[model samples]
Target: MNICVYCGSSLGKNEKIKEQAISLGELMCKRGHHLVYGGASRGIMGVLADSVMQNGGEVVGVIPKNLFKKEVAHKGITELITVDGMHQRKSIMADRADAFLALPGGFGTLEELFEIITWNQIGIISKPVVVYNLNGYFDSLIQMIDHAVDVGFIKPGNRKILRVAETLEDCMKFCEQEL
Candidate 1:
């Protein structure tokens, strides 16, 4: 499976989250899955790309030209594709991926995952989206989503578009079975 992983370019407060991202990448490679992600040589993205490459898995990184310098795009990637802007990067990644997984990250990570889910919900795509809820990092966000559903902001069925897992194995299994 070609899995697109959305994560942060800056490491968060917790070291465990970063470790879990690395573990997830290693697990994906071992399972014979390719990784598709933003080509940054920092933070969770960096850890993930390195893990996949070390484990002999294909890593396709997509980055916007404007942020290439700022993000310090990963040159060690199996394949790095540069685009004009964020939209182009996201478009290419989504098109190439069979599924999407989000690791613990900041607002940027949240934005990326939310965009994909929105795209899926609006019929732009039909790929499976999973969030690796490392250490319950997304607890508050998940609560907000539930509140949205309760307030009739979104239908209950729309909630089914996202799957949350506490571990890499659980997330991968959900992707293989549900996606």
Candidate 2:
């Protein structure tokens, strides 16, 4: 499986989030899954790519042209696909991946995850989307989602579209079983 991971380029203040990202990478590699993700060599991006490489798994990085010249691109990736802009980068990554997993991240990660989820809701892509709710990093977000259900802003059944895993092990298991 080629799994696309949407995560932050900057490691958040929480150390556990970074740990989970690394663990996920290693787990994916050990499971013989390839990784498709943003190609930054910093923060969670660096940890994920390095973990996969260390575990002898393939990693394909889709990076934008601006970031490439910004000199933060991971040179150790098995292959790096450079695009003209962020939208192109996201499209290529989504096209390359068979599934999507979102770890605790920032705005970029949220954007990527929301785009995939929205598309899934609208009958665009049928790929499975899961969120690694590391150390309950997404508790508030999940609460907000429930609020959306209560407020009628979103269909309550739409919550089924997202599978939240509290640990890397459980995340993989959920992906194997539910996705």
Candidate 3:
């Protein structure tokens, strides 16, 4: 299966989160799954891609042309695809991936995760969306989703679209079930 991971372009201050990203990459490789992600050679994105490659896993990078020009694109990935813009990049990544997972990140990561979830909600895609909420990183976000459901802003059934996993093991388990 091709698993698409949306993560930070910069590694956060926490060492454990970085380690978790590495572990997640290693797990994907060990499980013989291919990785599809934003093609950048910085932050958690770089670490995850490098770990997967080191473990002999196939990685497909979908980077926007602008970022590629900025020289943040991963040159060592199994395959690197450059798109014209962010929307095109996301479309190609979504098309290439069988499942989606989100790691700790800032606005970009949240945006990608929410976009994928929204796509699934609107029937644009039915792939599974998993969020790796390491150390309660996404606790508040999850609570907000629950609040949305309570206020009738979101359907109760739609809340299940985003599966929250606290560890790499849990994420892998969800992937296995979904795929």
Candidate 4:
């Protein structure tokens, strides 16, 4: 399966979260799962790709041209796809992925996660959308989502589109689902 991961380009200072990236890569490699992610050679993104490659897993990186020009693209990845802009990059990522996973990240990661979740809600895609809520990184966001459902801003059934995985095992289980 091709699991599209959304994560920060800058590896944050959270040691546990950082290590989880490595574990995720190892798990994917062992499971023979392909990785589809933002092409960057830094931070959590770098660690994840490197771990997969080191463990003999295929990684397909979808990177924007601007970021590629900045020399942040992972040249060592199995394949690095160059795109014109964020929109194109996202469209291609969604097209190439069989599932979506959100790791700890910054604004861009959150945006990507939400967009994919929105796609599932709108029936644009029927794949499983899971968020790795490691270290409670996504606690507030999940709360807000529940609040939206509580206030009827989001239909209760729509809120069920997102699967919040609190551990690596949960994330992998979500990935293994046929959806």
**C-alpha positional error of residue 172 in candidate 3 after TM-score superposition, expressed in Å:** 0.8
Provide the global lDDT of candidate 2 against the true structure: 0.85
Tens digits of per-residue lDDT for model 4, 70-141: 638999989999999999999999999999999999999999999998998888998988999998999999
Candidate 3 per-residue C-alpha lDDT over 18-136 given as tens digits, one digit per residue, 9 for 90 to 100: 89888888899888898999999888999999999999999999999888857499999999999899999999999999999999899989999999999999999999899998999
The C-alpha local distance difference test score for the whole of candidate 1 amounts to 0.90
Question: What is the C-alpha local distance difference test score of each model?
Answer: 0.90, 0.85, 0.91, 0.92
Error of 3 at 81 (Å): 0.4
- TM-scores of all predicted structures: 0.97, 0.94, 0.97, 0.97
Off by over 4 Å in 4: none
RMSD, every candidate, angstroms:
0.9, 1.5, 1.1, 1.0
Residue by residue across 14-124, what tens digits does model 2's lDDT show? 887778777888899888899999998898888888889888999999998888856399999899988899889988998998888888888888889889888878887
By TM-score, how accurate is candidate 4? 0.97
At residue 47, give the lDDT of candidate 4.
94
For residue 94, what is the lDDT in candidate 2? 83
Rank by lDDT (best first)? 4, 3, 1, 2
Candidate 1 per-residue lDDT over residues 1-179, each given as its tens digit: 99999999988788887788778888998889999999999988998899899889999999999879898999998999999988999999999999999988778788999999999999999989999888888898899999999999989999989999888898898777663
Error of 2 at 40 (Å): 0.8
Over 4 Å off, model 2: 177-179
Q: How accurate locally is residue 172 in candidate 1, as Cα lDDT from 0 to 100?
A: 94
For lDDT, candidate 1 versus 4, the one ahead is 4
